[model samples]
Target: MSVLQRVVKPTTHKGKKILLKKEPQLIEGPKKTIFFKGRKTSDKIRHVLKDMYDLKKPDGVMLTKRNDITIFEDVTPVENFCRKHESSLFVMGSHSKKRPNNIVIGRTFNYALLDMIELNVEAYEGLKAFESSKILLGVKPCLVFNGPLWEESDELKHLKSIFIDFFHRESVNAVRLQGIEHSISFNAMPDGRICLRSYKIALKKSGCRIPRVELEEIGPRIDFTLRRTKLPTPELMKDACTKPKELRVTKKKNISTDNLGSTHGRIHMGKQNINSIQTRKMKGLKKTAQERKIERTAKRKALTESNELIKKKKVHDD
Candidate 1:
């Protein structure tokens, strides 16, 4: 008997191509931040609301359609719930006939409001309502502290850490504001208030009076809010880390005995300060009290002996 060989057809009898569907990649960090929409607001206004945190939809709308950014009939219950969960931050949207495009972003802990910022929607063109489900991408916001609070106290530093923790959800270095591309300046006021101003960083032609370098103010001022609130706990702030490690103030190493230039005999007592008026060296270099007293006594005795010699010479001449 001859061996039989079978040939297989690659295509289906219906003439359809076999294809594999692409799997959607899940977004990261929505758990830390949320967008809460109020029930009374119009759907158009509510859905069109956008923040740096929200992702853009393919249909030209900003996506707030996630479980993290849910719609609520009342603000009180949602806020209370967020506090109970010890959430760091949540955004609340409210619009009315009298007030248009009102958004209140707040920081929360243990069901209490720490800081609340109210912003009204300005003119935003080309934004529509669409179904969106994407994560925040390509955001590097600069934080500028332009007032005394930048250095006067640790309060602003603590507050800044909380903001970093809330914004930096994706990676360890994601939320750092290094270059001027996109930025949020946390300008503090002397009156115990923080004026947060957001801007879109861009390069532009310099004026004749100024340098030829590119400018930083790109689009219209993004948003500004002023508020005062108690800082959140450390558990709620992970990214609010200390300042970029102060270049580690490299200490001068001890000179080794092998080096001839090194003198190890003199012990370093402490810092030195001089008193010019007293004609005295610093404590570390000062002469002993007994030595100073002896010098003074010697000078006085020499003057007395000179006077006595002059008197004896005059008596001999008489």
Candidate 2:
């Protein structure tokens, strides 16, 4: 006696699909002996069968002829036919020269073999060599083999659209976007000195114009440059407003007294000595207001006394 096992879709048989409750496990224990029976053996089918059973060519399942039923060499053609019709079928049998027995044929509705093949093709093309090797070595493949995540998900798609819009919006030339305007202001002083100031200003996109001026030409000139907008310190303003001291030039009158020889000579020498002393005192007194005022008062008193002495001496001589 012999037993047969098959896997198939459910729709063709009008039954619910056999959902794999758990992943299939490798068969354990002492290998149970089994045999294959068909009218003929095919190298292609034999190779696939060997791979499935993890068997070397010399130690694979045996194939023998049977007379009870006809057998096909490969089941791939039948599988393809089922896929085209949106159906599925599976068949298994034990064979002998006298009669074939223990035959099992099944149909399914859920499994889409064509879809599985397409998915495998995409994964094989997409996965890196290391990942593909792991899968070939019996590791479960992850979502890394799937297509672009942004193309597949709605949220990512929306984000991508927004990013594109932000980067690709209409652009304007940097020069044209900001306009330019020039201005000059002039102020005339009481002494007919005109202060002419020129500024090179930049108008920003926000409609604000900032003035930039040259500071070197700020002194007395017909066409002077404006200074930067920094406010002057109080000390600097005070220094500017304070007037400079006026330069004073003193006049000396030369006296020619004619007593012809001795008296006038003595007087002339005495007057020179007095003038020298007064000049020294005036030079020393220049820094103090009180000292300068007292010196001027003494000069006026000396002049009045000399005039009185000259009038008395003239009346006595008369």
Candidate 3:
């Protein structure tokens, strides 16, 4: 094969289609993740990465081999892997003297690096540390952000959204009381530290209609201090968050509802002439042709009588 042909075409049609850019879809599928490590990693980092992969479940792909790529330095390898694996989210673990037990959590947009954040794991705990039963595979997790710092600081705000996107499994309309099995809470400390905790929800029988709720710490607890953060530009963020036309709520005109739960609609019409309007056919309401003639004659006679009386008064004065 010629060099141009080899470079341009794929061996199979499926490969060719996979290489092509994806169009905007009305309904998106679950976000898949790729987990990998660097050439050098501490035991803590490995355990944390594996635990995260477990949380991601069937949608996650873990790469066993280590690579010598630094995401903040050059993101080419990460982007290539994202395209190859068709995964938008990634978690990379690396340990070094300067930043020990470090992990970078990031996501891609359109097979390109959109944003990433770096944090050092200060303390670690694995699932074995806790004795709670594990949650079901692919079960949706309820994420709770408990701290004013999440909204007060821009970096924490970004991290909060990123964490939600990473751990979110699917969109649901209504949740059952029994279906809520697990929850993940991100608590922001005052000293710029993060306490990531996982809990298993246990509903106990109660006399009332609502069941009593209990939370059990299910392991993989880790404390992280913020190190570095990178956010996408305003334009890129806006474009990334734009909703598809199919999902947009189109506004209806001239229709409204009031507080009383009644619907009202306004109708427009051209100018109306009362003279041409059709009225009730009752004799009392209708003016016949003879009645109309009589009314006009009475009005004319009254006017003439007033004129004659004025003339007589003028002649007497003269």
Candidate 4:
């Protein structure tokens, strides 16, 4: 006879417990990104990465040392780095004769690479090129995607989502009018290149209820041509997109909104006896025993009089 041995994992170590145990948070922290360069990089790629890092601000990690890793071939190093830093997003800059001025943007789920898109930086500009007041660090910028191609293909849709996620700093319930400081817009042209434009928002007095809005172009204008993409599997995509129960908006039954912004609801109820229902006890609404008796007596007298009239009418007819 042989006895089977079961291996049990240990949880007594302090460091292990601290590393493994994740406390549930009511509002999770903003997603952090890892910005790094590949073995070979160009001036344009470095500037792009630096500018993007500046945009990401306090929630981003910038690694100055070059890492020898290919994004499409082996993502193991990237995954390890992400796991170590607890980051969910990454942008890698690389340059080579084969693929010059290449930039890759990707996001992770469970510290694993979920999806990534590679783009060739066809044209580039930096912030120093424009003479305008830069947006404050940590201020969220409004993102705009102006192109029908964004909706035409799954790849374009994924790219749009990636861009939104990358630039979007934090989740906010409401934004004040004064908080609108900057905006980033992406325009996909028919030539299969995307134009990324940054602008500073200016609000002036309109002499009315609303303020007049104007956009001034800031620098760091980039034109990208999409090259390679690694999309997530359907199951992985679904799992990544799934929201927690607390975050989901539970639909209220029989509740609807009208065109005028009025909320309406339909209440279903069983048959109700109004007479048996208890109402407020008040002297004006209540009746004494004598009053109830008098009412009953009047009702009986009226019924008897009606019967007598009917009998007299029958006799007259006869």
The TM-score leader among the candidates is 4
Better of 1 and 4 by TM-score: 4
Q: lDDT score, residue 44, model 4? A: 90
Per-residue alpha-carbon lDDT of candidate 3 for residues 116-198, written as tens digits (9 for 90 to 100): 99998998999989987999999999999997899997788888988988998778878998899999999999988899999
What lDDT tens digits, residue by residue, belong to model 1 across residues 76-163?
Answer: 6656657444355666666667656666555654454455445554543222222222222445445566876666665556556555
Q: Name the best candidate (by lDDT).
A: 4
Q: What would the TM-scores of all predictions be?
A: 0.38, 0.14, 0.77, 0.82
Q: What would the per-residue lDDT of candidate 4 be over residues 1-318, giving only the tens digit for each residue?
A: 995958556577985676455433456667889999999999999999998888888989999899999889999999988988888899999999999999999999887899999999999989988898888889889999998999998888999999988887767888999999999999999999999999999999999989999999886899999999999999999998888888887879999889987999999999999989877487777888998999999999999999999999999999
lDDT of 1 at 298: 99
- State the TM-score for model 2: 0.14
Off by over 4 Å in 2: 1-37, 52-68, 71-138, 141-318
Question: Model 1, which residues run further than 4 Å from truth?
Answer: 1-31, 42-48, 55-76, 79-86, 110-112, 122-136, 145-180, 185-213, 216-318
- Which pairs of residues have clashing backbones in candidate 2? 9-108, 9-109, 10-108, 10-109, 11-108, 11-109
**Prediction 1 TM-score vs. true:** 0.38
Ranking, lDDT, top scorer first:
4, 3, 1, 2
lDDT (C-alpha, whole model) for all candidates: 0.49, 0.32, 0.89, 0.90
Global CA lDDT of candidate 1, please? 0.49
Task: Give the local distance difference test score of model 2.
Answer: 0.32
TM-score-better candidate, 1 vs 3: 3
**Model 4's lDDT to the true fold?**
0.90
Tens-digit per-residue lDDT, 30-72, candidate 2: 1111234344334433332233222112222333433233323
